[model samples]
Target: MRFVLAIVAFVVAVVLVGLGIAQRTVFHESAKNNLTVELDQANPFVVVGPDALTAHPGTQTVSVSGSADVYVAYGRTADMNAWLGDVPRTLVSYNKDKDRLTTAGTAGVYATRSPSPAPQRKDGSATDAPSTAAPTASVAPAATSAPGTSVANVPSPVGSDLWLNELTGQQLVTTTLSLTSGISLLISGNGGSVMPSKLTLSWPVDSRTPLAGPFILGGIIMFVAGLVLLLVGFLHFRRSRGPRRGRPRGLRGLLHVPPRPAKDVTSTGEARSGRRRRVAVSVSALLLLSGCSPDYWPSPASTEPAIETPDATAPVADPAASAAPKPGDLQVEPAVTVPQMERIMQRVSEFAATVDSSRDAKAAEQRFTGPALANRVANYTIRGTLTSQPAPPPIPASPLTLTLPQQVTDWPRAVLTIAKDSAAPTVAPMALVLVQDSPRTNYRIEYTMSLAPDAQVPEVAPASIGAAPISPEFKGLVLPTGQVGAAYADILTSGDASKWYNSFHTGGDQLVQQLGVEGQNTVRSGLPKTASIEFTTRVTANPILALATNNAGALVALALQQEETVTPNDGGTTGFQTGAVAAALSGFTGKSSKGVQRVTSIQLLFYVPSVSTTSAKVRLLGWSESLIGASELK
Candidate 1:
């Protein structure tokens, strides 16, 4: 019995040890190694550099004047191309003697630049560049010795490079990427009060280590031991019910009392009873051994996995009903069907025929949302002019009638057909197609109408064209890393900067204060209009940090002159107001408010660095506006 129990205990311990090893993956292996990165929080750009170079677009080359042995880190060419200003530019024109960097895609070399002194080569050969034009001028950095500036590149594990943005004030250890190379590159650098003497490149390290004394592992062992012992006790009881096989037949016969006559039945009964007692004693011994055995137990179960229920929140079709078809799918399983569409057109045509001139304009207003409806109110004019209204307008439809491809199952779609009034010079037909993705549904409706001279049609949402919908890109403005600064640019050009400044309104003052207070430190000494703002020195709010601190994130910034305008120029007012400037500024709170009032166009740039690898970033940008004038009228 003791031997059997011991064997069971050994098997249980082995199974549990295997389980513990599998659970080790949950810890982060890089916990011992610190990594820092600097990010342009305002835009999706991170400059990982100092010694590394990345693949360039169209053989685009970057010359470094500040650091020796500068490395460039390059991402995939296709992704880099998507960057607004990172498009491959022809550096030199083989044909035109005028061969500096230009938009034309042609081959060329730097007119005055030196090739890399220690460039890494793919073929394992070192080579010097043929003499070109004079080497590009080098900027002498401040003479202060930089301590521990050695940088190195640790090739990220394939498919493991993470995209990171800056958080708040923590030092960044970043890998700088430059596109000087023809292909992708990566350069790693350190951060803090000082840089590192040598960079240690690490692959994804194993996160788990043996716990102190392996307490958890030990506890697990004991639990398994107890469970095995319990199970063995039960098994031993079953075996004990059978007879002991080792007792020989001859010994049993010798020990057994001879069968007695009827007069000796009592003695025979007593002998049988004694044998039964011995059997009971043997069973008890087995139970005791099994109960104390350590090998029969198994580890206890861990936390239960979460169970999922049907998500009532989602829009689901009833199991008992037919599913709704999507527009992209072909409902008429055969070829394309124009008859159904034609029937809809007929109904529209009939409706148009009955429209009376007096009632048509009113009816159109009912269906229009904003400017479209406004056009009908005044014959499409801002003033109350009804003159020059178009006769019958042309019908609207897609340039091509599309058929659903076989690959689609249930595509969502909607169609609206509009007819023209024959009495009013045969108004054109109009068609509107709608695609449903709920709040992001795509709508396309086109119609030509005699509109006000100033009226311009708004573009359809990006989702309508089967693309991701991003907010409108700000015009005539560029972000720190060259992205179209959208929302922040609008705030800079909000037309009421002076008014907001004069009254110290929270929104307007926020911009002004950020520019004068926060922005002042970020600037190196150049006036706002003269120096190109160095993006490296600026910082903004760290959204996650704000949540951790103030419980909210707010935008603050530097403003651009080009974005702020008093009146609309070639660019429309875009929601910004235009008004005359009031010269009499009675009260001013901040020193920045005392400046002379003027109108101009500008944009805002904002960003912040990180605290931990996991912290949020702060950001800032410029604001621009124009002074009101007589020429600016609603």
Candidate 2:
């Protein structure tokens, strides 16, 4: 019973506290005057407060000056809201500066003061509203100050805060105060020495409004009574169950029933003997069924299935299975011959010299089968006539050919043909390498072209015979390379360590580490400067680049423009531009992840000082979409 009462009291307390919080936020004080008094059109409200407002508990009188408004107690209730309710407030005192309103009251109040004589109205009639002009100064007696300060003198600045109306420049003095529970005041003051800008008296609203004190007192009284009653009942129960003066010991012993009985024989022995025998038989039965009884026994087997097995011998079927052999299976037919690859390379070289599309080379590349061929195809990038210079050796008797479902064109490729074996051939692993482009390597392009020469060149010239001849305004190229050391110095001076570190973390870190390892391994393998190198390539173009990629179909093809010249007269002028399609994708290998789209189109001008004259714009013009088909680029 006591536990049950405790739970009820706990729940009541929790609910009361929750209601209090909700009430605090939703309920507010309602004032009596609102904007009418707070923002009067005729006269502004002014305020005055204790000289030492921050002083510890001491009697202080606040005064209001210069207004004609009466104050009253603006009582606040739960029903009143901030927006719709009346402002509840009461003024405490006024200042004759002579301390005329010095009487203390239990509550603050608002007192009205008669306004000074009104000025003539604009329509030739007198009115209560103060004129837009400044108020006429009255020669009033000075106020008396506390102790050391004189009544006629201005007090120290610390204890007083003043607020002035922006338009009128009338001052208002503010002071702080706390109020009692369930009671809040919002009073406006008026009279002498009161500043119009600081006429406010507000208090925090009571969070909870419970039943009247009498009801709560009654409830608490009832709860105490109930607790007392409960204690009395418990005492009575104990007394009733207490030892009885006439109770027999033998009966008490029988109630307890120890395992062994006393040696002395007593009355009812026969009855006790019979009870003992029955108890023994019950114990014997419990022991006998211990293992079989549910409480002491193991659970039965579960009803769910114990195992599942798949059909290993089932036949699998796919229509494309015949088109391309699996990686491990080498039973597919051949495509291109060893001699054909050599011939392709030779043709590509000639095409590269002419800067023409190697579309046929891309077509022949797709006929390869097996993993080795696929691996080689995946790693190949921008394989064109220029890449064909270092031609590969003759293919083995059974060259590998990769068989992909997708078609590719206008790209020179390396085709490998896997041998006729049931097992797939493993391609040799390539060494890791990393290439760095420092600020020292930074290059910028600036082009200035003039009309081409009037003299015509022979058709045999590589640049003249293909497509169109160089523009007449083809001025020689000029490249100005800056010192890498100076670029490093610039980086240090720019305070860009964080940006550089972020770039390193992204992918450059791994690339650099891999490059370090490759360099070490190459030296260990007796290959010094001739170590296998991997290039990290980046392609960038003008803001017009965004237009080309997004509006490729709309852009019309233009004629090629080429030129050759030495270094130009500018900072890092080793960059040039030519109209051409650019396409590239990184991180492609035989062990590449599946389910990734790997193809894209690129149209960009290629520029490199080592490859050709950096000052010249070597234009390789073509539609990237036409050159690199919509096949995957991975």
Candidate 3:
């Protein structure tokens, strides 16, 4: 019974220790975030978060686990996204800065990004967003103190990241990320076509917990319990030995001396020898079982499937799964990188500089087409005539945004919304349009117009994930992008009598009140009865841009030109010739020629619905007007 009791206690101790250790093994692995990246030789990476990236509270080392086959690189994610995605493959040429390149085979790819802006309150004050650092949380801001200073600011981390790509079919990847200020993961795809899909990040619940305390404590407790039982068993054997010290214990007392029957002498000496031998064998077995080894039970071997035990010499190639949210009208991935955007923006800026210059008008000419072309030419003509000094290149304001990809088909289109700083004190920022026809073609500046003071830029997804482009003919709002111009034109030509008139703002009415037949009334009432004036306005071209907003609406910018022509009777009555008349009649003088052709170019920005279910009415946010040409004779 004593031996049996000792075995039970030892077994219990072994189990407790094994359970505690098993729990510890379960949590050794940390968390991760994964996503697919389409490959492009020109731009080959999808930048992840530069959000919170501190190591687990108790973890000694935070290492990103990945493979060499897919390749990797790293860099510090900076607050400035200046040349973000445009880093050349061999960056040494473009950048000779101290920031070293993070290449594969040495340091793996990892990065950090600037934190998001805090939300603002109704009173125009800023407020904090929710926290994003607890386990399983999405990316969010984290506070950090500069080295040697105690002030905490949300600055960009210093470190680069890596890209993973494949040659044949898509490659399934599992990359372990390192612990630092934060990181952004970059990945490329096969042939710039077959890209990664989605990512699943798995890790222990509490990544900070190191070797769990319960397991170690259980092990210690069991060791002590085991030793106590072993000593007790041995002591009992010592204390119980006085009586049957010389006699065999006989295999746990199973073998006993029966009262020697009276006929013991009758038994052969050979039989007695055999009995004695069997007894000796049993006693020897018991002693052997109870020696140096504890006989109660053996400590349980680990039943855990496997553990990610830290090993410096051979880093484990942790496998990451692949898949992503299916692309739809809205995608969380960008169509271009920061570098690509910078290039696009540069071209537009250069083109804008060319606007006030005659040296390279063709470059700007190629970019401006349709109404935009007319607007640019008219601006040049007007500015040449109106300004006393050489016009400066239009400078863009801070906080420019690139509308993410909106078109879903192979022919995806996006809009680059630039807020041009205009000299006109009341003028709102100018919005520019950029369009790319295909993957290989470069994005071209298609149009530019002013946003109204009261208008807010439509909310769109981040540059990483693009917004869906609304079609010109989309009927989701009160009107379609294509129809707004015609409708507004009809309203302008006929005034409130038009049915679609109320669906729009009172800008048309205001323009009418300002330039209506009453202006002609001046010529009608002021001029002789035989001579009269007529005013005609026409929509010169299609809407230049139709950018999608998050509310299933669009911000459409269009061009409208209104021409006022005057005529004289056979009596030949003379009328006032404004400088407009002088400019139009510069080299010609005739009494009966069309009195004067006055041209006023109008650029209008309107908010129209791009989706079908919204009941929101169309509103005109802002507009810009210019007398492009006022000729003497029509």
Candidate 4:
């Protein structure tokens, strides 16, 4: 009976082990799920929507082929659609039911009208309409046509500042991305003339088998037990067959030492050996079981009913409570995302560094405009002659302290950012006002000012929910944005006598201390008796940009031109001091027979509180001055 049971256990062990091995081999599933799509009609560009990239709940592996050079980029869905305006493209999506990829031809709309006002729900949250309404037939030109006439000639998506991240390769490209909702990918070929014809997306799958380990481990245990049982049974059979000793047993019982039954040494040795075998089997079973983890075996169903415990910190539902506001409600998307702005800042910093090292004023124009560009060019020129003169402060890229972007959906947009240099602790932080004129152009620094050491920045909307652009004539503030520059200039010139002096906060104003009535008197007192000086300031034609703050105030930026003229008191000739910056800019060699004039360009940034606020005042946050022009009076 023991032998029969041992054989049965052996048979069951063999079956279990074989089944476990098979489950790990032939029965295993693939590690990844792959879906490929081949376009029937090639367009100049392809857009992979966010839904398709996030079809599976893991990282997506994207591959593209059938083009000499393949380029892939991912950005906010809205930005991708905006860049594709009026351009023909193909849309790629996943069909979950069919477990395959689908493609449709689409064309973006190019609206000529201004962007509509942001829509608001009853709860005061904001929402935006979809940019692309529906799918349209492919409008890619059949053959090569005039460049401007064909929609196929759209600008290459390669180097566009809109992309958050991008990948490129020759002939074929593959990349892995872990993206979230509202982010999308765009694919195109070099020169925007050809599009990749094939695209593949793959995601990893879980392939662990729970029962394999348990089955193998159980089989090992049974095999060892069967061996022990077989050994014991064989030993018992040997003892039973030992010497047919009925008579010997009787004699040994009378005189147990008659022959000692040959001492039954073999029986004792066999018994000890059987015990050793059982011990070995037990040890082997323990080792095999110890190697396994919980995942190796199936989880057992609980027999006891689970108790429900109330969490002490969990909030109780209130019948009168208002529902939480939805994301993106009352919030318009900024002109650029935070990551996008960082990249732009990096690029601008690199270019500025090159320009600074080379003193390339012409090259600076590419990244600067208006007063910023004029100031940089003037500095470069001054440094060319005055080699000992220090260059303008460098623009740092990293560690952006504040970023306020304009909420708009049109060609022109603006952003305000404050950047600080970690390497130069003595240098003050710089406030930059950047503007983008159109989609094709990069953002330019329109105004750059050094913030006051003790300046306190007002609260503003977050980067995700950008602030609205305020008009120069906006009346919500105590002072109109358009008149801020002129008002401040009056305070600087007339001091307490100026009509607008009380409207500004002058307690901690460095510009007023250095360029106000007191400073002007000091300069006049030092002038030679033969020369008379006059000071005049006027607002320039540069556009004023103002953005709303959270306190119903506005942050305003404007430029002013201040001129200083010096002439002989009694027809005596007067000239600038030796080696002066004004002399370099004006190309004056000696005393001027007429008179010498110096024009200083001032960029001012002010925060004006709303009229509704008590004791409202306009505070100067930052300012920059450059001797942009100087010449001999005609």
Query: Which tens-of-lDDT digit does each residue in 524-557 have in candidate 3?
Result: 5766666667667666534245555666676666
- Residues 428-500, model 4: lDDT tens digits: 8999998765554567788999998888889987777677766555567798766788888888789999999
Worst window of 10 by summed lDDT in candidate 1: 541-550
> Which pairs, if any, clash in model 4?
125-329, 125-330, 126-329, 126-330
Taken over the whole model, the C-alpha lDDT of each candidate is 0.27, 0.24, 0.45, 0.75
Off by over 4 Å in 4: 1-23, 39-42, 106-108, 116-154, 192-195, 210-243, 246-331, 471-480, 610-616
By TM-score, the best candidate is 4
Per residue, candidate 1 scores C-alpha lDDT tens digits across 316-352 of 2211111244555322221012332333334333333
Q: TM-score order of candidates, best first?
A: 4, 3, 1, 2
Q: How accurate is candidate 2 locally (lDDT)?
A: 0.24
Which candidate number maximizes lDDT? 4
Error of 2 at 192 (Å): 15
Better of 1 and 3 by TM-score: 3
